[model samples]
Target: MPKQIRIGTGAGYSGDRIVPAVKLAEFGDLDYLVFECLAERTIALAQQRKLSDPSKGYDPLLEKRMRKILGPCAENKTRIITNMGAANPEAAYAKVVELIEEMDLAHQKVGLVTGDDILEYLEAEDFPLSKGREKILANRDKIISANAYLGAEPIIRLLKEKADIIITGRSCDSSLFLAPMMFGFEMKEDEIERIGKGIAVAHLMECGAQVTGGYFADPGYKDVSGLADLGFPIAEVNVNGDAVITKLSDSGGEVSLRTVKEQLLYEVHDPANYITADGIADFTKIRLEEIGKNRVKVSGGGGKTQPNELKVSIGFNNGFIGEAQISYGGEGAEKRAKLAAQILMERLRILNLKFEGLRFDFIGAGSLWPGGSPSHIPKEIRLRVVGRTKTRHDAEGLCNEVEALYTNGPAGGGGVSRKVKENIAIVSSFIPREKVIPQTKTLEVENGSG
Candidate 1:
């Protein structure tokens, strides 16, 4: 079709900044703008919200983000792709439709990819816990959500159907970029090397600003300018599956070899084999060339056959975490904080409260480097006590003990703060490829008319 395609990364995570995405939509001249907004535990939290309100499981910022970029994206004919649907793709699709109607962008068409959720099909016995292969049935009552990581097949199908916007739940992050390449270049499933090259491009761009010097900046050794106005990444991929990583010319950020290398190694367990739902990418052979001031050409990635099974992330209620913090200042702050911690322990013991676990940290005195000698004692230190418990009552007791330290034992104990929250734990398991049946749905408006 076209000689090359430009894909811009909009959002890297669920809570990423919105301004960069808006900028991309307005001026990037991208063929596709992808938002990778789902994380391992985000869907689980969204599921909890869905249980409370049937129509609100998707990313909370979906509406705001869509409202900001939808009009510009539709005007520019830059198709949108996002996994922001989170736990509810249908509801997300409906919301997008409403936004389109409200914005009167009837020229745009929306599509949703579904069936990644397999909570109903999963039997606790069939899929054991990922950590120890423990039977999932043990925590059946607490399980909140289970979603499989779909690949690019369904997205490719949607593109073939000419869907302008595609929403999904838990699709592979790289697949968002790969789908367009596969569709635009007419690449077949068996094209392993080409697919791998595409995957390499996706992995590099998936984290948005990470490739553009956001996370890779170190003050003295490696430095990036204009951090506050950093631009998201854009990949100009060719039919051959090679790509050049760059950003908007007027944007602020550096796309250098150091930044690209750091991002390439991020979250990669093995350089030779980076696994995903679609296929296993061999990044060992990937080569990067600094083609311009803010452009790097990438090629030489290889791919193996797709995995026989797909990994699924399962979320369950792990219990509750109770935490409280109190600050001590003026000479001997460390001693006072330690005394406060001791008093908390003694109080918990007196109350005969049995917590699953407990931890005490002295913020100003080597909490991060535990047991390491501090060069000097600070004038101020904060004592933070946290505990995990099976029930809310037990958790509340832990927090209350820390709060009571102000009046009962410690001197100059101020800035007392306490919080209790339900802990959503995650586990992973795999299922046969045949088990997941991904389908697509389309919604369109005719010539700015609903």
Candidate 2:
């Protein structure tokens, strides 16, 4: 008889801060533990790792945690997958080997999937990282990061090798667990519709209790309950591929209708046509419920066909940026910040540099206050100017030049200079699955390696 495979994920503030997810494997009958980390900036950091060090990229802290978790999982025989591989899977894989050895786990095979960091490799292939290549703006040399988000198929393939843990580079968040489920249940590709629906299910529940009551209305706690030990969500997916989102019995956070709705709206723009590499899921069909305090069940979640294209994220040389700040202590400080930015913009035009972009913002005065029109007023205001240039030096120059405004131009204002970092390249494309490979190869590592 086939075992009923269970899937769970660690949830956090932004999908990256999933400290609670580290404990998810301790729950009931978990066949696979999937950790989804990385966003636009993460890809850029991974690419930089490759350029700076060929054997760098994956997060070391995550590796350490995996080592600790694997001890118990290896005892129970659970497989794991994560995109923590970043730019350099070889280095990451070696670290995993070190951890496994420290735990003295026997017969633990760790599989690494690479080829996700193709930024440098693409340049070598004369690919030059063009924008809209496969419909994604492949940010060329200016790219801060480049990572290929792999789907679940490759992971499923790794499971066939009897690997205890699978490490990957930028695999889809849903693919982390869905791949294992597919492998365990022997799901097929022809069932693309079902596969797409499963991906949607994973997305809905990936943030753990977030879909339940964490983000929902919890008048009792004001927001989420048990703020300290909030539990992540798990899916008990059946052979038919249907999933139930739940958490450990003694975990934190609440799974309520409000939380589920918040999770549903996460990064979802088109409710009718949300596509993943696996399949397409319809947002309209999602039926959520508060089955228990920390349990939210989903049903009737199936949708239309997915587009042939895949969304690619690309980062490129957008250029360097410089920022300066000024605080308005006097009344009408909010008005001052806005005027200061406008004045600085004019000054730059006179200087003929004009800056690539410039922005003035208000802080503390509730610039973030909801509603197009602010309903309430606050005390004090901060006026800040940020400008970006094509080059780092140019940006620095602007920062220095702006500070001069305090003495020569604006009143009751002071300025400071700060450096900024490159975000990431988000490119969308439609590449046939055949064109991409999961890089399901492993490198042998010595005992107690770095």
Candidate 3:
């Protein structure tokens, strides 16, 4: 029999349900449990938090997640890999140590992958933002974070060192899984085709429950059962990088050919040339077969060698978005909602409040679909007014106008609510691979000998 490793996804995003992760850690007999929780703006928000309090920049749920799954992982002898470090891997590393000491799992070793933060690199070099030659020097003050999408080489090094728990900041999401596959299979860095095959498996498993029918639900056309207790995904990958995408037999979600195929094409712009930190994978040639119920065998992927330049995500302050909503019901609700929106717009105009951006949506009255779909007129409707501005004062000025509609402008404009939120924008640029030198260090466990 060919050697293989069973890897499971615990949490897909920062706010994913913890119960599924606990289930995955406990019941998904596995070699590694990966939690991919960093979105593009997530690390930027974390960087903001870090600026306010140096020790508080990691994921808020990191402590809770570690407490829940650490013991199960130790019991199953399965290692943990995650990018929950967000903007602060060292602080996250310290927190994990504190948890292990408290839980008395002193033999468990944790490691950190560093050097993803490339703000210093950007400052040293005047790089453009994305495709445009617009230099970043003008908006340098607004930048919160600049992190490179690191590949699996650093992670593979940590796995070789036998770190039971791995923490990283802004790693390429799929690289979290590819690192283990490469290490477990002893696949070298120069093996581009083999690496591409591994990338195919990594991309499928990166989104956690996404591959297990969580996002594959359509009411009549594509119904997925038991979504209330939807189970996460587990990929069984062999030496040749062939994989079987599956879930627990008793788990809620299904892993049919449809789900696997959907996730393969998810976010893939060019099916023949999907780019990543590791290499460019070709999804056009991937073969998918439903060998058994909820078990799909995936293989046959091709690709080009890894890119010479690595992409870096730049997070910056992008002003504020202010929003307010009011509802109207019973008799001509759509008209009432539209009239209320009109009132807010005219009111803001009279107040001489200028906004960077503004929008008025008459929800339940063809807001989602423009030019109007022929659905029955809603018995009730909601009017939402949103504005984006540079200052919080302007943002609040935009929301206050909507609240005034309750009494000053429209009748039955009840259930009024408003909010103002800071918007963190994300942009990308590229840097040479040689510039992003990742380093890994193992955290020492405390009091192991009994």
lDDT of each: 0.89, 0.65, 0.88
Taking the tens digit of each residue's C-alpha lDDT, what string does model 3 give over 184-264? 989887787788888998899988889998888999999989899988889999888889999988879889989998999
TM-score per candidate, chains pooled: 0.96, 0.84, 0.97
Highest lDDT scorer? 1
The sequence of per-residue lDDT tens digits that candidate 1 reaches over residues 35-63 is 99998899999999999999989999999
Clashes of each: 0, 30, 0
Cα miss at 333, model 1 (Å)?
1.3
Put down candidate 2 lDDT per residue, 1-450, tens digits, no spaces.
255677766433223444565567655467777776666566666666667877676764565567557765776666777777766667777788877777667667889887665555555554433346633333354556555666777777778887788888777777776787678778786666567657777787665556645556446755666756767777777766666677777767666666667787788889866777676778787677667665666666666554554445556656666776767666766666667777777777677664677766677754465353355554456656677777666666666666776776556776454565543335543344444555786544334432
lDDT of model 2 at residue 229?
Answer: 71
The ten-residue window of minimal lDDT in model 2 covers: 10-19
As for candidate 1, its clashing pairs are none
**True-structure lDDT of candidate 3:** 0.88
Off by over 4 Å in 3: 128-130, 133-135, 448-450
